[model samples]
Target: MTATCLLPLFETSYVAGEGPDRFYAWPDALILPQKVRGFYVGFLTYTYHKGGFYLLEGWFSWFIVIWTVILLGLMSIGGYFMFRKFLKRLPKEDGMSILDWEEHYINETRHLWDEEQKQLLDELVSPVPELFRDVAKSKIAGKIGELALEEKASKITEDLIIKGYIVATPKRDHKFLIKKLNEKQIDYSRYQSLLAK
Candidate 1:
């Protein structure tokens, strides 16, 4: 996210009150997060009790104002530096720059590689079941499409459905089936024979 967006996430203010009549105020010095929009915005507010002016009649009144100012100044300075540091620490998001795109691409590629490896490993260790083989054979019959020798397509597809990849429908269309297959990143023809069954 941009510093502009992060600015408002750190916004804060203060209020003081004793009863139905209350007071609110904000710092005199405003600190803002950096932005490429060429503008900075900060907010403040002041509220006074309906009839509490007498509360400020003593020497403590000046002390309260001075203390508030000093506290706000320190907070402003601290906020500026802290936000600058936070921005530096933020992980980059997509679309802002080429580096972001490259990072995303690399991560996607690695994930795909890992998935393929897992699939291969699973295939090597487990034998295809007989029901799946029969289903695969039936599915390939009329279309003249030859099924892969893996012969476990039905079981695999069933497992995928169980895992939430595929959904059952009362009516099926070839195009919609293909679209769902694509969304799952499965090879289009991989299940063609199996599906016929």
Candidate 2:
């Protein structure tokens, strides 16, 4: 565990028609070394005015800020470790296996079809222009169904490939796609071309 220093906080108030007035609180003036016995722990402090401690010691606002910062820092660290573990569990994409057309298709249309018998007929069809902006619009609408289908299926139908509806590639196996993704370092468009046999 690392130590963090928390400094004192100040409070001020101002009237709409008047000027600023500073309210000095005891807790706001105290600073903790943060590290105690090799571990960092935060504690509240009380201040004495002139002679003794009273009911009105310090502003509660400072206490809130100090604890909030500490809480967020711990949460961020936890989140980082959780993500690291998730990355470790996921399968690495290499040449032929890099293509996730089937998974992508399922995810995109999961809500529309039953899990047991999901099919491509549920997807809406639209023409996507070769231009980047047009293709992006088509993708957002989930209209590239034909292309997605061809990317994953082992056997491509002659009618679909001839109509420019699906992408075909020389590399048919999942390993080939994974290998291409890893060894060739090609972009997604390049993958589409490579698959478009």
User: For each candidate, what is the lDDT?
Assistant: 0.36, 0.38
How close to the true structure is residue 54 of candidate 2, measured as C-alpha lDDT? 23
Worst 10 residues of 2 by lDDT: 117-126
Which segments of model 2 are wrong by more than 4 Å? 1-5, 8-62, 65-102, 105-197
lDDT of 1 by residue, 53-88 (tens): 212223554455566679899999989967765664
Question: What ranges in model 1 sit over 4 Å off?
Answer: 1-55, 93-197
Q: Candidate 2 residues 11-72, lDDT tens each?
A: 33222222222233344333333455886444433334443222222466356556778899
Cα lDDT over the full model 1:
0.36
Return model 2's CA RMSD, one decimal.
17.1
Inter-residue clash pairs, candidate 1: 139-197
Distance (Å) between predicted and true CA of 68, model 1? 0.2
Backbone clash pairs in model 2 (N, Cα, C under 3 Å; residues 3+ apart or in different chains), count: 21
